[model samples]
Target: MKVKSATPVDIFSLTDQGDALAVRLQMLMPGASRHHRPKPFIEIAQSSFRSGHRCIFICSTGIVIRALAPVLRDKYRDPAVIVIDQSGNYVIPLLSGHEGGAVAFAHDIAQAISAQCVVTSAMDYSRPIYTIGMGCERGCPLAFLQPLFEQVCREMDAAVTDSAVTDSAVTYSGLASIDLKADEAGLLELSKSLNLELHLFSAIELRQVEHLLSEKSEIVFKEVGCYGVAEAAALCCATKLTGMPAELALPKQKNARATIAVARSYAP
Candidate 1:
């Protein structure tokens, strides 16, 4: 899979460590333009906000709040505001969480840097959304796929157990897979059993997010024309469902007959 074109971003950093992390993020998010301790920080922030650029501030939450306060408008009109600590340990959606798409944006940044997203919006508490991606041999049976799906869901639950928000009632919104698997009986059965819609993506669509995969397989590419099936499909499906980019909640896990992965998105 090939990378997508970069999206525009404005990144502000306070300290040397923050600047360094900013540089790394700039590389990851190719559209980012960095500002390292500008003389009048508030003015620059206001400019960015007025211009409607998504902003990321690698400083204390207070600094960002103060700088953007004057330009703050209603959530429907405000640009996304994200705050990250100097160490890049946490990514928080400080403003316009739902209307401005900051919650989903924060999740994407956090996943790219392996940071934890600290989303405190009340909307997030209402059932978390997840999509499961799977790939299996031609004749794989539901008996084999069902247990693997359960195991991966358990894995997802365990992974988020220590996070800031732990929703025990997380919703498995759908199942995703390559178009080749659309006719697979096991997948059809699993979709029926779970009462979840099945989403299938072409290999070309899956390739767009190939850069985000944690693990890629040459063998899989040789067979499917994409580096991975489970992870790419899960991410593609989640992005489609939420109308926002998604992050892998769990990387690809495999058993004898099938492979599974999970992706998450916060709907705006």
Candidate 2:
């Protein structure tokens, strides 16, 4: 199923940087209003809660928790709440994770701003997580990488025939590659475009998943010390994310300058 547009959002910020970030987020969220350094914060929070508005707090998680403590009802009745740090490095689903759609909203916000969604909800543990693994020629241009990435995503969308799986279910949670590619411009740009963290694994780390690779390449091994870059990195990252073994969701797909693969895993 297609994800719905976000509901009205109330963004709370305590500092100038947080306010700026809040404003940036506001532009992306329809019907979002900004509340910079809101006085009587608890009262404002309670009012926002009563209105059933989705809330984004660009401040300390502690402050948000304290302010909202008195007003919280239950997960089913509370509105979705997200906490984003001033630096925008992380987006967290702070309350009403599943029933209120905070987890999914966190992912959407993270993707919009190139931040990582740090989802810790127990209900989220049962969902599948996808990671994209990539290998590209040094200095490969974003022009080459973006289209291939989109094509792969489209293929994944077409392949999801299960009635229970929605389009949102296949949203990629992160990108992965050998540590050697950590500075690769194209890979970095693609990760920025997707607004997902690019997790780098060492060759030794990638080797741990060699047995699961769908194809092996001696040429790649000679260069990167791993049998495969795309597939192995994908699986390795997914495993790391979920603390469980990962399977190849899409085996390596390559064009002239880049190779990409997808891996899937479940959190225990």
Candidate 3:
């Protein structure tokens, strides 16, 4: 979907533990600027917020929130703020649960650190989101891809709700495809239309999740070296993103030009 890459992070660390955690996070989040002993903690944080960079504080949540509280604006405009304890045992999304993606970002950091992610967003548990995996021809037109995507979601929603009145639209957090199709224009447009990111996974990574799919196809395996692109991609990306196993909310389905599937993460 060509969404902007992650904002540069300004990580503030005050102790040996914090410094160690910062190094670990750098591997997962590139372009992160770690401040072992930046001027004053408050000054560093305020400057980061002013510059529109994500601020990661390796300290107590209360300390971070209190220090940044003066400059805090609405969540939509504020940069994401995350707090991790010095011991690195807990990761918390202190602000920007959705718009700034503090929740998901915290999960990513926790996964890398083997810590628990503390998310306060209720919808994260209640309204659960899924990823849509798709594989299509090289130059499939939007006309074919868009409608096919909608059709798959509708079918999934109906299955989940199990009601004739299932006319409500289903929401997906992101789109996924094989690494080869990472730059596919149709998938890019579909992600833009849905306002979500496109997650690309390699065939080997997709294969790792094949055992989780509802069914497998030898034809797909021969073609992609993965049992099923749609289901496998969906499951693999979800597991990677959440650091938890994911299940197919909807199994693979296809049209003349596109194959699709849906996978949902377990509630944290």
- Candidate 1's clash total is 0
Residue range 187-223, candidate 1, lDDT tens digits? 9999999999899999999998785576779999999
When sorted by lDDT, best at the front, the candidate numbers are 2, 1, 3
What is the TM-score of each predicted model, taking all chains together?
0.58, 0.53, 0.50
Q: In terms of lDDT, which candidate is stronger, 1 or 3?
A: 1
Per-residue accuracy of model 3 over 1-268 as CA lDDT, tens digit each: 0111135678888889889988777655557888886778788789898776778899877778788889998765677788999888998888876555677667657765678988887756323457888888888777778888888877776544532212456667778999989778888998898888889998898987665565778987788788888888887777667665565667778888988888766445
lDDT of each: 0.80, 0.81, 0.74
- For candidate 2, what is the TM-score? 0.53
Predicted structure 1, TM vs. truth: 0.58
Question: Which prediction has the highest lDDT against the true structure?
Answer: 2
Cand. 1 Cα-lDDT: 0.80
Give lDDT tens digits, candidate 2, residues 1-268: 2222324679999999999998788776546789998888889987997777888999999998898898888875677899999999999999977556577667767767888999985556457788999999989998888988898898777555322234443689889999998889988988998999999999999998785576789999999999999998998888888886566777899999999998877675
For candidate 1, the per-residue lDDT at 221 reads 94
Minimum summed lDDT over a 10-residue window in model 3 is located at 158-167
Residue 98 displacement in candidate 2 (angstroms): 25
